[model samples]
Target: MSKALSKRFGEESMDRIITWLEMQKISKDVALLDIGTGNGVFLIELAKSGFTNLTGIDNSSTAVELAKAIAEKEEVMSLKLQVADFLHPFPKLSQYDICIDKGTFDAISLSPDHPAEKRSLYQQSLHSVLKEGGMFLITSCNWTKEELVNHFSEGFEMLQELPTPKFQFGGKIGNSVTALVFRRK
Candidate 1:
């Protein structure tokens, strides 16, 4: 099955994402990376919003295939998809203007019932790919907005917290959710 990552965060999240991207000051040609991207929802969405330069990475074989098919079917010419685990060591990145995650790190932040592990995992996994001053936006149900700010504060500057769209669950269900937008320092 394909991963649609229905964690809620939706269209209302775009203005926040786009605004954060602008503050990062990534050039028009800068590379945009979506880590733990499942089925390429944001990649396709961003492309339609005028961001043609993007790449999405997922650990699932099926996800990469689905994302590819979706990209092709959607006529998204610039989005690239690959398979890779976030926990494993990845080759160094020399470039990238932004990195976005829809809780891939949060998913890994589990410890057989331990919840705090996700914070550490998220910090390290994101460290490798995020360029100096690159932007980061993460959406999670595990931590409150304030907690997220403190967690990423070590390497990122708390830029802004857009009211993440609602979900059917805790916040708002089915409202195309909301996420914490940040800039790497």
Candidate 2:
């Protein structure tokens, strides 16, 4: 599944993210956090793009270990991978300059019970970890741009909508994947 997703969304999705980062003119010294850093692919891409201050976290121990190994293999000296649950706030750490989510919310929302219970928690945690005016980027297959904007309406201003590959859907431009960036207020 990881390999398949990497092949499908790796280049195009990452290019969109890179473009957003460039537009923001985020310096290499600014802290970055990657929620649900599965296999650390996105962080690796950012690292390759000259992002120096990078950190990633996931609840899965296996994933954290894999991400650590991959980071080492890719020689990302400044990247840190840790095992963490995003639903809980991190009191020991400071706010980040940027926080990114790629399919993390989709996985959390897939829970059979109390799916939305954690959504609020995650939002609160994001608020806690992200500095004022900091950016949050999210990419998902489960939500449309409007849905995502509505979901994070409070304390955020929608900034940019990344382009997605549209297919013929009732004579409209429809896509399976959507990406958006928002700034905290």
Candidate 3:
């Protein structure tokens, strides 16, 4: 499980999120949502870490099915996995206290079909599903910290920026990925 998560989402990514959760003193019983949960590995990890109320959603039915299978195989069947598009109105689910997104915003930003509209809709959908003052943690390889802040500035405020690997190129150092936590306003 660790190897699969490390290969798909760098080990550091998950570690940093867990660290932040601890730093924030988030309760294990908080209603947490995993946005764009691909295979449900992260949800399983959260379950193993003692998070009780876990829900994951992906636009692809196949991905949701895969997540369900993986969760069952790992004996973490308490998770709620469903197919829901973030750019559209989400299905009726309870508002979450915390939401995590890994690479979903990056994919939406790259969409050629009305990228601006999709991005706006994504924010709206997220806002609709997350409670006021809810925390949103996102990890992206396609955008810088500054870019992400600018994108989500309207209804969200930056809380913390997680450290990522840096590379030096032409005497300039930059991060390969940006992980940010925001609070819904």
Evaluated with lDDT, which candidate comes out highest? 3
Q: What residue pairs clash in candidate 3, if any at all?
A: none
- Per-residue alpha-carbon lDDT of candidate 1 for residues 73-106, written as tens digits (9 for 90 to 100): 9988788788887666468433677888776756
The order of the candidates by TM-score, greatest first, is: 3, 2, 1
- The most accurate candidate by TM-score is 3
Candidate 2's error at 92, in angstroms? 3.1
Per-residue CA lDDT of model 3 for 51-75, tens digit only, reads 8999999999999999999999999
- lDDT order of candidates, best first? 3, 2, 1
Better of 2 and 3 by lDDT: 3
Angstrom error of the Cα, residue 69, model 3: value is 0.7
Residue-wise lDDT of candidate 2 within 88-118, one digit each (tens)?
Answer: 8567445898999988898888888798888
lDDT (CA) for every model shown? 0.71, 0.86, 0.88
* Every model's TM-score: 0.77, 0.93, 0.93
Candidate 2: list runs displaced more than 4 Å. Answer: 1-6
Scored by lDDT, model 1 comes in at 0.71
